[model samples]
Target chain A: MAPNGVNGSSGSHRFDPDFTRLVVENMGPNVAPRTRQLLGGLIRHIHDFAREVELTNDEWMAGVHFINSIGQCSTSIRNEAHRVSDILGLESLVDEIAHKLVVEGDVEPTSSSILGPFWSPNAPFRDLGSSIIQDPNPKGRVALMHGTITDLLTGKPIPGAVFDIWQASANGKYDFQDPENQTPNNLRGKFRADENGKYWFYCYHPTAYSLPTDGPAYKLLQLMERHPMRPAHIHIMVTHPDYRGCTTQLYPKDDPWLATDTVFAVKNDLVVDFKPKEGDPKATLDLEYNVILPPKDYKGKL
Target chain B: MAPNGVNGSSGSHRFDPDFTRLVVENMGPNVAPRTRQLLGGLIRHIHDFAREVELTNDEWMAGVHFINSIGQCSTSIRNEAHRVSDILGLESLVDEIAHKLVVEGDVEPTSSSILGPFWSPNAPFRDLGSSIIQDPNPKGRVALMHGTITDLLTGKPIPGAVFDIWQASANGKYDFQDPENQTPNNLRGKFRADENGKYWFYCYHPTAYSLPTDGPAYKLLQLMERHPMRPAHIHIMVTHPDYRGCTTQLYPKDDPWLATDTVFAVKNDLVVDFKPKEGDPKATLDLEYNVILPPKDYKGKL
Candidate 1:
């Protein structure tokens, strides 16, 4: 009876009247009626899952051990476990699926995936056109990315849309997760769009690389017979007060790993070519992008 | 995807590649090939159940809140929450269904029901035949309880079976939970059988009563149109090295609530009768009794 107990039909053998009793009794005194109903549904779903699997003692123990390992692997600077959660897409699934159900105008704050073990909350904010080089890894061809944020309905520019961007170094290492990376804020910065809702940043082209293989997600990838490679890209979270936030990635043309990215994060709209400009180096670096934002009235957040 | 990602099929859409990705990414590392097969089967069952119910968003949130409330309500002194769990019968269902899967020679400890909120872990032990009347109230007819513990298979007396027993006071109140009744530890005691596995105790008849209606279980009862009555009984936990430990209740005949106990704890084999001795008040104080334990080879203890 996985968390969506209503539709779940299996696990009836294991579904004692007690499941309902435990849920309701333990719900405590202060819970709202709506919350209680929600919880009861969830218990059914979780129980259904357990029943569907006819979960064995050994398997249950393994799950406990797995969760314990996730905690153990989390550290001050690295949260391999969190990245594993994100790569699995639970954060996005929960956020998007839940958001889709919410009605207009009363949406909760959208919580984007916080990729674990590979991000720093305190990365420095830099102005547009500033370089995002951290340390001495061989830099690739420079890319100048320009983009506009506009309302999806009116096409009106949304000035001050904040862009929080990060990318792996040339060696596929993040500053906080990799001690060998020397840049204090390697390849990570926050920028606000100008009055015209346009902004640009300068950074070396990223190279496709595999996620760290030493962590739990890597081990899971191997067990699933899946690859761990992500297409070369820059991660971005775009936000404005009157618009829904977007967490996305931009991949370059013809990356070998694009089609089979381990995270399933590649969408058609996010793939763009860095069409090289002719002759002058400055011309060669230019890139222009336009992103349509969900309007204020849409109000789908989670 | 309650806990195990089992709800993929619950939605109107069939599982897409995204679902497969979720399966591969969320399953833990080191999951054996066989385990994956088993998990796959389970997930299908879970998804089926979800679709059957067409569970809604608000319902799912209710379920989540319900689980969270269980954690919040749990504490050392009282597990009224567990009472609710027991009423649901999930506790017993899980115990009975899982019991058979236990491998020989690898039995775990006697997995008790969710510890009810009233246990103190420090009940005082008393001698055989001692009365539990520190402060008797609304006394009923006196009954002499005598019992000899013996192996079910060999019919040999177990010399040192320990008996921990508790019951509501004559007026149907347990000391700990009944604030209006008495102080703590009043109607509970532990005793050991003699070499012949014989013991006796003087106590008044117990009356069936309802569980607390001031909590969420009560609200649930209202929602489900159910009552909160239990059969008149005494709870007993018996333990010996040669056999499995058993926690059961001794019910009195002709009790109105026997068949419809809120907790669903009654078993025909556990019923008992109290014979009234009608001679001199002190004469024939001793009564003969016998308890057939489970088979000696029963592998339920650690």
Candidate 2:
């Protein structure tokens, strides 16, 4: 109408590709550089998608409704939008790309992963070699997890490096997920590295677990006919005053879900072996992982 | 990580563009054809945008927060999300593309426009030649609007074609928006076509008005340094059982906002001259427009 106005608005299902430019130009001129770049990219791509698909009016309205539902379903305790991002591998991809520069020469720093919804603030502090297994082996085999924290640049152990560790039980449930059987801090602990930067603790052998199945993300996965299982792994957040903190996850080498991790977060360097503990009274498996931290002041080449 | 898994997750801010294919692939096999096409297009475009911009974690998070705030602010009374869509000119684009095929032979049907948030059902049914100007001329000039409805294919006047019309007062405020100064349903009415398909009514001359200035859409306009005024116009909805309904707005040719209508909805055929009426006591301006309707079952070539 109005001779297609300013953008050659036409009477066809397909939009003129240059309409993207018109949309960007209409944003006026007060925008900051970064905002302009981001908004411009989004406008071009979104319009491209709509045009490529030849999205009908009903489909566009449906998409809008889906977005509104995601907002309605999201809350502080259950961030449905974040869950959607995770399921789509957006969060994982972003974290990986953001932290990719944390390397010293050819040696890459420990790859960070999604901090899944199970983590809580202020984990219970424990001794260097104390166990995080507050509950008796009520559901699965006992495991001893040990690791060393080192500087990615110096390739040397960092003593007194503070780290937080938490994982789901062998039954595939976190402490909070199974309130009746697990103790308050079961399989969750905070520890400091010893003189040699070694830290060990006892916990349950991890197992794959299903994400919440009640939200829109779950419904989307169902539509895709995809499962919602995350691979068995231990969550780690290691830090020191001289190093940049790294929040990563360690996936056992042979976990079935690793190849199809629902979150797409299994980095090769983060996979480790879980050997059998030879002669321990309270442990059955020995799980070992090592963490590498970047210098606090490190900046990648621009 | 993990040899890029199935999609080749890489370590660059510019994501491996093919990762979009991988993201779409992960959607499994149960999706309907239409859903798959839509999702695939969206995944491809969204990923392309992220990669093209080399989006940072901070920027992504800011976008997520903005989406959450939009959901929180949206309601039946004030749909901030729709407001955002309107500001971005998305609604206009979709509506234009959807109605582009309503043509017969060489004649294009009346273009459809957005059903803006102010529309209400159950308007007072008035005589075809009566006045919709229930309130006194307390703001601006009185106007006489007259039009004929005809079938695009037959080129014959359509008798008994039902139509609804509404507009803001000369003060640029709708009746509901300015309750103290305007009577209920002032400048709003439902009317039927006469034997000759002619319709006429007296109402206030329409004028420009600003959109709500307190929402995120308003704030975004502030960031873009763009004005929020909409051009002077009257809303019209014409319908008949044997023809497709058309919802459109008429923009006066000389309105200052026509060149840069905030919503980008001015079609050339929808703009008309608001001429000065001669020797008329009840009206000063004369507004005339013709409506065209397509057959209800008409379908475009696939």
Candidate 3:
């Protein structure tokens, strides 16, 4: 049942049809039920795929090498594996299915979205209403974002809610993605809701960007002849001891490729307007949104 | 649709449920039909699996890292991906389905097994009845293996049929798998059937051995609580301009893992006896196998 091991012969011949059942049933009892289920399902689907194509050794080898290349393309900051998942729409489906499970009760929390590979866990911590702009001179108009965190069921603000925020500069690159041109953590920071459950920050507006095209993941897109564009968006994650944490992205209302998002992270509720602001010299654009956090013990959704 | 990219938006919100159809339908027309079918099937299955498990973000991240690890664990000689395929019984099922496509008519060629990952295409050539044991002395009794090549339908001899043969040494290590202890090409060679369609060679008998226990593949086995031992096998591949090529393994009768070959490669006809022969010092053991090669244009089973 191990990935490197094979078959169900006790030193004798093995039958073809019986092989699948044997492989799945032979997993030792020590395997956790969840592991057994996951691995069992995986093995069945893999076998089905091979049989459907009558896959040959050459094709098998091709698959093996591709899997390895995806792994090789991954790094701490860039997950090529996640990219493959996205390309295959696995990530999108998971996002949707996970959210639906949470929206079970009448009081539905805000839909969750994928965190994506650009999230920086170590972004600098900043005070409320401060700018995440790390570069002295940054591109794009200044955009102010403010949001409140409240319990979904009780409609009460949750104070001290943690938030991790990150976005691409107008040039369409994250700090680490364009290390030579952008300072580390540029337009990226961590903030917490105040006593009033309000948190605010400012950063350069976002723009549509192309995914990395230099890796095996890109080769897959080329094979499918699918384009590799993601619309402009800001990632926001909120967490607190009393509430279920959420990781999501807020999409600007005007970029192209929304319906054809390669990862399927978009939801109507998560889309908001970044209107042009006037009076305040510090802000060229302003937006406001609020999050409905579910309770921590909620055996709810994604 | 690149791996590192996500979503479709003209810069607006996206609705759920429409994602899968959009993603698939959006693939460019340039994608080859077979590529489309294979990739499309893969995408659907991957999405289905993720939803079946209601997979979580942590689980998804774990999968990404695991995929990367499999690639990192692989090399030119060791295919952890193939090992994983074998573990899931995909290799075995593929073998069965391919072979079935060939057994359409009454005349059937030999069964094809997995080529496995240890094959070296550049083995030294050996004369009929020559020894693959390059070392002056070797472990295990000498195994004298001789085989005849003939057309499955005509039952006629096929001369000059090429054969690539390899097997683990007495210590259960292929040359590359045990570089420090085994000499290059130490029980491996290539040969051509004589005008009579007969080919023979000798080598130190093989023994059951463990798969590499130091990689991700091995980790999978641990999770499944499966042993890594493989039944002793002699890798044999035969090809000719006039016939369909076959890559298979001959299981030595009496090996304990025969029924449960880690790769599920064992076949009844492919299992042969290595009987003792006391007459000449060069004939400590003997084996005879006749290969039935189908025509090169054969639209036969594997």
What TM-score is obtained for chain B in each of the predicted models? Answer: 0.75, 0.89, 0.86
Candidate 3 per-residue lDDT over residues A184-214, each given as its tens digit: 8888888889998999888767778888899
lDDT of 2 at B144: 85
The alpha-carbon lDDT assigned to residue B252 of candidate 2 equals 82
* Clashes by residue pair, model 2: A1-B267, A1-B268, A2-B267, A2-B268, A3-B268, A267-B1, A267-B2, A268-B2
**lDDT (0-100) at residue B139 of candidate 2?**
66
Model 1 regions lying over 4 Å from their true place: A1-18, A76-81, A98-125, A134-136, A139-141, A156-160, A178-180, A192-197, A208-230, A256-262, A276-288, A299-302, B1-8, B13-34, B37-93, B100-302
TM-score of 3: 0.87
Query: Residue by residue across B13-122, what tens digits does model 2's lDDT show?
Result: 43444455666788777789888877766665555556556667877677766666666667756677777777776777677667767343778888888878677686
TM-scores vs. true structure, each candidate: 0.58, 0.85, 0.87
Looking only at chain A, give the TM-score of model 2 against the true structure.
0.88
Q: Rank order by TM-score, top first?
A: 3, 2, 1
lDDT of 2 by residue, A1-302 (tens): 01112211222334444555666787767788877877766665555555556667778766666666677777776677777777777777677567757333887778788777788786899987688877765567777888888887788999999889888877788887788878788888999899999988887777789988987788878877789999888898998999989998888888888877777888788898889998899788998888888888887453
Docking class of 1: incorrect
Top-DockQ candidate index: 3
Per-residue lDDT over B1-302 for candidate 3, one digit per residue giving the tens place of the 0 to 100 score: 11111221111122244555666787898899888877766665565456555677677778778888898787776678878878777777776765654355685687888877778878998898799887534566787888799998788999999978998878787788677777999888999999989898887667789888898877888888787888988888899998888888888899888876766778788888888877868868888888888887766443
Candidate 3 Cα errors over 4 Å, as ranges: A1-15, A102-107, A136-138, A178-185, A194-196, A298-302, B1-18, B102-108, B177-184, B194-196, B300-302
Candidate 1 retains true contacts at a fraction of 0.08
Candidate 2 vs 3: which has more DockQ:
3
